[model samples]
Target: MRRLLSAVAMLILLTSACGEDTLAAGTYDGPLAAEGRQGAAHRVVECDDAPTGGNNYPGEYDNGALSDEPEAALRTAFDEAQITGVHDGYVLVREDDDRALFTFTDAGRVRQALIVHDGEAFGKEGWYVESWARCDYAELPAAVAERAGVEIWFDADGPVSTRRVHSADGPEHCGWQHLTFLSLGETTYVRDADTEYAEWTDAPYDSEADLPPHAVDTGFHRDGDHLWRSPDGTRAYVGNREKVAVWPRTKDGFTCA
Candidate 1:
């Protein structure tokens, strides 16, 4: 499944360059890519089924009141399960009598979906995480999106606007190479991905000088991050306020030759 998802992501990355020009350019049909090294990071673990050491709150509450204060309810539920690191910036995506979906970006700029459901567990009625996952640039699954009542824009290739900096050297460990930087407003998402490893970093700069010393130039001239590119576009000298970083493009995903 991992290999298949990687292959699918590659195919999407290849064909998504067409954008809206192609028939299926703007659609995405796949489960939320499980994050983390274990590949089970997104699995939903019921709080009641597991031992919460008395963290699980077993009580009766008004459904309408709980729905009105979703965040508060979720906080109580998360506390019951000892779930931490989720707070603020909660956008209610979907809410029904049985369940509600909220989306938020953590401090690392990784988007996450939190599902709180109203059901009876251990003879108590409350809200708890049905499931949650790290959603970087991919769209939510069809069923999830449908419940959210929003149209998610999915490009087969990847993010619509991004600057890709190919590693000067070929695959390092586990065929990891390219660095894709996506800037959305004030937030910049730096993603490192390959056949095996995938990681994201939030590196937002206030100005050119604020950018890190080794920051790769994404060819956005207006942003003051300039790159002196070779005539063939294989080599580049990325300039910043203090120093310049150089990268020689690789060919065939392995060699600089």
Candidate 2:
């Protein structure tokens, strides 16, 4: 299933560029807008189970809730899982390119897991997003939960930049699906696959009425920088900042601090 999703995402990224001519010549200098979208709200229509409001889009995405508070929800899940032990450090599990989860555990047993996100893909219209999901150890895809158990610690304090690479027609095409976060003092920047391509504009495409009927206008939080890997490790995300450029993760672009 992972391979299939990756293949499909690559296909989308490759085919998405073919429709670029639909946009007017030159670059779209205007603020990203969902001008022609069909629905009054801004969100991912493909997520049919999502709630009614832009902020509530996650009504039930992939078994997640729009109203779920990351930290609080994780606590509930911990209780249900009957997890017990002293608090341990956090584990950053890369599910895919665009989504990831920060699982806080105790003695290698996952007690709580929160979704780490970039405010770009799954938030408000033209805004950045940082949301979380709470899942029991069993709820997590076996691979991710297992990886968490193995204890892979990501070096978050490394130089804030790294190289991201991709082929014109490969999983890297939808690179926006996988993201890593970096901090430069007060400001934060997220690096991912989408950064490398100009295939899609950061426009809030709420409806198919937009240039591409398939475009869904997502929202995000702007208070800080966010970087998330989609649960599948096939996509990437960063908070929506106007005109943010994507850089390729090639060579030794970044290292552990």
Per-model TM values vs. the true structure? 0.27, 0.18
Output the TM-score of candidate 1: 0.27
Q: Over the stretch 1-257, how does candidate 1's per-residue lDDT look in tens digits? A: 01111212222112232222221211112232233321222332222111111111222223232322345555664545434333334445344455544544332232444555555555555455544544422222233333322222223343222212211222335343454332332332333324232222112222123334444434443224354433544434445556544333433333223
RMSD of 2: 23.9
Stretches of model 2 off by over 4 angstroms after superposition: 1-88, 119-257
**Please, what are the lDDT tens digits per residue for candidate 2 over residues 67-173?**
23223333443444323211223333333333333443332233333332222323532211123222333322234333333111122432111122111112234
- Where is model 2 poorest over a 10-residue stretch in terms of lDDT? 159-168
Instruction: Give the C-alpha miss distance for residue 228 in model 1, angstroms.
Output: 2.9
Write down the RMSD of all candidates, one decimal each. Answer: 17.9, 23.9
Best by TM-score: 1
Model 1: lDDT to the true structure: 0.35
**Residue ranges of candidate 1 with Cα displaced over 4 Å:** 1-88, 91-94, 104-160, 163-224, 240-244, 255-257
Model 2: residue 255 alpha-carbon error in angstroms: 52
